[model samples]
Target: MSKTKNSFNHFAWEYFEGLEKTQKGNTLIRKKGRLELICSYIGNEPISEIGSPRMLEVLLDIQANSLNKAGKPTDKAERCAGIASDVFIYAGARGFCSSNPAALIKSQLAKSSYGHRPAITHPKDFAKLLRAIETIVGDPNTINSLRLLALLFVRNGDLRRMRWADVELATGRWQLKPLKGQGKVNMVKDQVVPLPDQAVAILHKQQKINGHTEYVFFSQTAKKHQIISENTANKRLKDLGYQNIHCAHGFRATAKTLLQEQLKYPLVLVEMALGHTTKDPNGTAYGRFEYIDDRSDMMQKWADYLDALREGRDTTEFRADAQNKADSTAQLKALIDQLGEDKVLELLKNKD
Candidate 1:
């Protein structure tokens, strides 16, 4: 039997070749590897003949023998399924395949326990982590990268690929096309990062070092780009005794939690500042500049709160401390009016 033009191997390669045109760096490599894995199982089989059950069986066989990047036994089956689904979708659009067999099979894969990215969410604990970062004695590029990571909380790839042209220190804004936004999904493609005073100062210091380079965190040893190694920030965290306690990507979770829970920022504004794609009530996606002014204020407040936390100062919930203090005063005055001034003073004295 001869393989057809639309055989799994030929069509999947066609799909991936198209993907390679749009993707770069490790992303392209990883997707290609996953496609190869799937093709290894059914390379010569007609893609149209590979139903959901057959796909599931091949994935299960791969799962049984492979380990994930974290060395987990779950393997790359889930990711392979995703890649296969993409290929089938591509093929279906051109009338090569009728349906995606790789879809709806992820739930049937082996149940595996994977840990969430470790992060420090508690304010006090996170404060300690910040202080520890300040004391880290190493390459200034790595140190400043970590500092900016805490303040910016963007994906590590975004930070590493940060360019001088995108950063406006005078206006304290970073405008860039986020790597994740390069997909077919309609998201906030151009993310506007409002830099705080502290972050601006760090960038100023970095300017003297990397101003001549393309990337803000320039590195001579980086093979993929002149930017710093992806592990630079996390490796420093590990050296600071935060091996599993925290990592570079943890800052996003930490900021997301504290910005809503501790800093008292509105979820929509916080999500916007974090470059997350959130839909409005009408199901329309918000643009990057939708709430620019409000997000700017939130970013500043978040930076100020982090400063307070690092200095071991009173890290009151952002924008709520003053109102809360005023409320307390009004309650005290009402009590004093209900009782007598002398009685209220006596009660206060007793409480003290």
Candidate 2:
């Protein structure tokens, strides 16, 4: 009989839950929630004591089990398999087991593209989400928090880490140090995102809330706390009859879709707005700040357009001062080395 830390025993899930904050631990949690649910089916058997054959049987059993709350039995098993596989990878890394029984279980998932796609509901659904937010604004802090998220479109993780010092009232920007990108990669990673007007509105209101707290969106769980779980905002959106489809992340997709499809802005502009390009050619190259001033207006206008769209208005009053004209003589080639190469290639390929 073998006994070990990840023995697949009764307390194994609890042990894994303890690892949720560190990088390795956090990676597990990213998919851990799903995995733990599968583990629950394994009962109190010690995984270390169980041989590969037994593990395989357990996996198949979970696959066939009916999780009533999960609607269809196959869907529950598919999720279970995915999480179980994640555990195997983590376990194998630590030499717990070499075989991954849960691996390739997704091959059994029903239909195409996991049978689920992002849902873009009718505009009223989005309006209802905003209205849900409206009802909460009476709680001054919640109002500020929602406004910050709407304006910045910061990932739920990043916003939760916001601090007051990051806010520059004069510039209407937030200078967050040590971003989520830093934790995910080994290279030079911290980034500065300039906050637009609507985001600043949060701080403008925050100043009135005792004004001395360190966090811009401090959680009520503790004094001077800066962290707000991603679920905090998500739960609020769900409670108000809005599905996840129309919440914080949808706003980001909204920004990307409108800027890319509707507005026809340059890709780099869109990427910059979304804070893309974090390494090597992407890193130093994006730092040129060549169009920072120009992007300020573009980003602000994008937010205004989202406001209009959410308002169910056919006519969107754009910030013309932002749209009227481009006053810069900057060339695309100067920004992206590839553009210059592409031009050369075009000339070479076509002789006059």
lDDT of 2 at 224: 36
Error of 2 at 263 (Å): 2.6
Which residue pairs collide, candidate 1?
A: none
Least accurate 10 contiguous residues by lDDT in model 1: 315-324
Model 1, 232-339: lDDT tens digits are 888899989999899998999999999888877778887887777888899988888788888887888888988898888887646635568879989999998999
Residues 312-347 of candidate 2: C-alpha lDDT, one tens digit per residue: 665234634333433221343444465676775677
User: lDDT of all the models against the reference?
Assistant: 0.86, 0.58
lDDT, model 1, position 7: 89
Flag regions of model 1 displaced more than 4 Å: 1-6, 66-75, 89-99, 110-113, 184-187, 317-352
Instruction: Locate the minimum summed-lDDT window of 10 residues in model 2.
Output: 111-120
CA RMSD of each candidate after superposition: 4.4, 9.4
- Residue-pair clashes per candidate: 0, 1
